[model samples]
Target: MKFDKPAGSNPIDRMRIVGQPRDRVDGPLKTTGQATYAYEHTEIANPAYGAVVGAAIAKGRIRAMDGAAAKAAPGVLAVVTALDVGALEKGDYNTAKLFGGDRVDHYHQAIAVVVAETFEQAQAAAALVKVDYAPEEGRFDLAKALETAKPAKDPNAAPADEVNGVGDFDRAFAAAPVTLDAQYTTPDQSHAMMEPFASIAAWEGDQLTLWTSTQMVDWWRSDLAKTLGVDKDKVRVISPYIGGGFGGKLFLRVDAVLAALAAKAAGRPVKVTLPRPLIANNTTHRPATRQRIRIGCERDGTITAIAHESGSGDQKDGGPEAAVSQTRLLYAGANRLTALRLAVLDLPEGNSMRAPGEAPGMMALEIAMDEMAEKLGMDPIAFRVKNDTQVDPEKPERRFSQRQLVRCLTEGAERFGWSQRNAMPGQVRDGRWLVGMGVAAAFRNHISLKSGARVILGRDGQVTVETDMTDIGTGSYTIIAQTAAEMMGVDLDAVTVRLGDSRFPVSAGSGGQFGAANSTSGVYAACVKLREAVAQRLGFNSAEAAFEGGQVSAGNRTVSLTKAAAAGELVGEDGIEYGDLDETYQLSTFGAHFVEVGVDRYTGVTRVRRMLAMCAAGRILNPKSARSQVIGAMTMGVGGALMEELAVDTRYGFFVNHDLAGYEVPVHADIPHQEVVFLDEADDKSNPMKAKGVGELGLCGVGAAVANAIYNATGVRVRDYPITLEKHLEQLPAVA
Candidate 1:
């Protein structure tokens, strides 16, 4: 179905199941430990284990490798090195070569894999394989490399100018009465997901099947085939359950490639799980960014001019962090400029994580907003409200499909008790603690992709939906079941959703928070076809037929839906395509984050008292699952604010804290309380589901809100991320 224009009153508007807060369909399996992950699959009997050996140096060429001891190790079946694979083609999605001869692009790049009877044996044998490297000096620091940084054009990014500008930003900024300029830094961040990268590969003749933990099923299948130089049709990728992704599992990692190679060398199936210590330097991470923001406003707190420039580093073919994306549209300004500069660095590949561009972008931009508000002597929320725009600031001819930023801020302020917040820093005190509240506007661009699904109507009146869409702990199965149930006129329990299989129809595949809306719309399209098929079999006009209560009604006559498929099961397959609606109208999600923090006056130890998020992201399919996603993102936002950083060892060009022991994340005790509120909205221009993504939106501005709160509490502002206590210790206000 081609979505050429805004959606009209469709079957989903019935709200029988789609809008209800339904429990996850896969909840029982996950909670009961019955959901099998990639490495836990037991279908293949007597599978061998593979342990990867990583290169010690970040950039170099392999002088020689000695695998004799590893070959003779007890229970060792085979030791396969990159030399054995020879020269191989890199996948299009991969920035660095996965496995090849000699060249080392980054630290912990897999050079060899040892296959053995048990995981312990493989790990022991992998340690026995020794290698000699010829190290070379490579660019390791973003600040040092910025002198040679250049504008980068990413194919995957939305079409925009390399240095986008509207009116004369320089003249407007110079003439403005009030202005603020600041520079902020966000450090490199690891995904630090629950499950590590793991895969199980088996071969049947020349065909290969891989059970892997990945977010995009089709992307992995096709990329694996490309990397192996084999027929794409011969490879199958399956991942029914995933512990968590957060954009870490969106690509084809080394585990899947190593498992496939080891299985081929050992003449049996092999399972490979990347060791936790090696994950930080071997896989992708959110790149560190240095952003400079300049805002000019009037005394009345209306923004007149704004400029955002960001610089980030990556490998040779990698793209920039895109930290200026949100600045181009978040506020209304006649003179605006946004630009991104990319530098080459010998660090781990930089890619998407959670909200990606906007996550770090807002971490800097919103803090600048707060600073500008202070310059104008106005409340932060009021300043944001005064600058809210219903159309894109860069392209005013194009209006936003649905914009509720003002509503989000107003509602969030009222609910969070904004009046109780003390505007004067170091004034509000509760015993030994200083209290303050902060607010930041949240924005994430809505993206839609082509997605397909197959729906089956059983003779017994049960409906089944199959797609390659992955859950990734986002409740894809439940929301999909809700969509199918609503469209088929059946109870939610009667519909089954099978996902994360290469053989299934290709879906949007769970990244950039686009999974829910586009994937469910694909299912809706397939269900529409099924409804038409049922109407034809029942001798009713398809246009006039209404499906409800497991019955089809037309012209005052109603018949059981089962009669249409009495002879056999009916099948329908379709996908949702787009024309120019997205181009004509700017689609985006808006939210507001309010955070309260208490800082110990003597020690500078900050504690989050409470948090709340007000979202206006179109119609929410399943409020239960959507709330879970939002709160989870809010937790990650807390981590980003307080203590999540991949400590870089610049001298060696690697992450020093490679293991969980050194890396810090937020624990349950760190988050005192969290509340999520979704506004009642349905965006017709978005899709038939009328739903936009909320997972990423929940995280966009949270870090800034927390940072602003800390500043408000202590009268000290730290522009750097993670807002560590050490950065503000000496500058904190004295306790009276």
Candidate 2:
């Protein structure tokens, strides 16, 4: 199925099943404790447990390991150390070698894995395998390290990069009657998915099978095959249901690889689940970023110059956050530049998190826009509406397939009662608390990827869709079932979905908020072939055939679909292919977030009153699931604004806050009433699904709304992330 041009009104245009807000088909099984997670799978014969021991020092040489004591422990089957992984090879994505030996890249790098009959025995034995280390100094500060850092080594990248303006930005800002320049820093963040990294690996001769909790199953399988020096065809990875990923599980981690190696050594199936404390250290984190924004606008509120520069630290060969990607096309600015700088740091490897660049980038950019709006004595909504750009600023000939940012903003402002908000900050007092309202623009690019799937039409009129797309709690199963139902002209109950299995066709696994739209479009493409097969088998004109109510009809002839499939099951496999349409258009999702917050005068504590998000992403495939994605992201934004921070231990070159207790996310009490409204719209250029993306849009600009609200209420602006009371307590006006 080639997505050459914009999609047309096919069977999906009926809006019978695709547009309905439906509950998850797998919800009951999950709630009843029947869903099997990676670590919970004990169906294999003689499943053993494994526990990992990490190096104590951040940067050090491992002197020795005394595993004799651990081997003497009861039920201790085997112990594998870095020395055991002779000539340890690194994966394509990892820098600062995994399973480090002789040299330590970061604190708490895995040194050994202990396998035993029981989890407790493995843990107890791991604690006994002690080693001596000679600590060495390592870099953890971004600013200090960036001084000597170099640009990433991607030959194909433009500028490689040092983007500059066509016009003088300094002169334009100096001449501008209204301008705002601010610098903001966002701290390193943890994905903090509900389920920790877990994988169960079993070996059958040279072949390996891993039931893991992962996002990119095929990527993990290929990487594992490369790391193990085996054929890619020999490894099979299955991950049908995931608790959550949020970009944390998008890449293969130590649990699966180490479990496979340990099991092969022990000659038994082994399961490894990283302890909550170890997840923050061993796994990747969203690198902390320092962003500087400069916006120059005319007196009437037209942006003349805009720039976004972001900096972050990672191992060599790694790239920066690319936080400026949206700034190149978001609003209208002739003289604009965006650059990403990478620095070397000994902290844990920094990588993608939900919305990654845009999430943190918007946290700073949106607030700066809000500040600029306030400085100009203009409404934030009007300021954003005036600067809306329909075409890509970098290429003026291309236009967006569909853009409703202004509609979203205007509608959201009206629905949120923007007129009720008083411009005066502390003057809007509610009871004893000072109240204020703030709004920011949300923008996230609608990315597409090559995706494939297979569908089977059974004799019982049942359709099953198979793909390697992991749900990650994003309702992949429901949306997929809906897609099949809409395509096959059947009810929702007639479709079944199987996902996250390497045996299935490769798909654009859940990441970058593209999973729902792109993956389901792949399913739609596959089902189209199946529909034609069903009609042909029934000897009916496929063009006139309508599948509904468990029957297929064409003109005056009608036949039961079950009978059409009686001659064995009909299988169809296809993929969604892309052209250069995305290159020709500025494809992106947009939304507006409005927030009301109250700041305590005496305590310097900020509490959210109400929140609302109005989005203009193409089409809503499933309203229920779409709302869940947006609301969950909004809740995450709350955490990013007030509490979430991965405190770095600079002295040790590691993230000091290693556990959930040390790193806090938002709970129900932390977030108040929240609502989301999706504008009825569609973008044909995005794909057959006519949807852009909604998962990451809720995150873009949400934190900024909270920060701006805090400023409006307390008249104190905190540039750093977490907006902690410590940064404002001293500056706050003394209470009466």
Point to the candidate with the largest lDDT: 1
| Model 2 spans with C-alpha error above 4 angstroms | 93-96, 151-160, 164-166, 734-736
lDDT of 2 by residue, 1-736 (tens): 9998989878877888997899989899899998888888868899899999987887768777779999999999999988667556666654446673566777778889999999999999999997878788788888788777664432212345466444667777778888888899999999999999999999999889999999898888887787778898999999988999999887778888899989998999999999999999888999998889999998888998888887888875566776777777678877776777789888888888999888998899888888888888888889899999888776779898778889888998898898998776666776667788888888898888989999999978789999999988889999999999998888898888999899999999999989988998999899888988988888988888887777888888888878888989999899898998987887889999999998877777889999999999988999998999999999999899999999987877888888999899988888899999999987888899897779999999899999988887777888899998888777666431
On the 0 to 100 scale, the lDDT of residue 625 in model 1 is 93
TM-score of each: 0.99, 0.97
Best by TM-score: 1
What lDDT, from 0 to 1, does candidate 2 have? 0.86
Each model's C-alpha lDDT? 0.92, 0.86
For residue 460, what is the lDDT in candidate 1?
92
Candidate 2 vs. true structure, TM-score = 0.97
Q: Tell me the tens digit of each residue's lDDT in model 1 across 251-332.
A: 8999999999999999999999998999999999999999999999989988899999999999998888988888988999
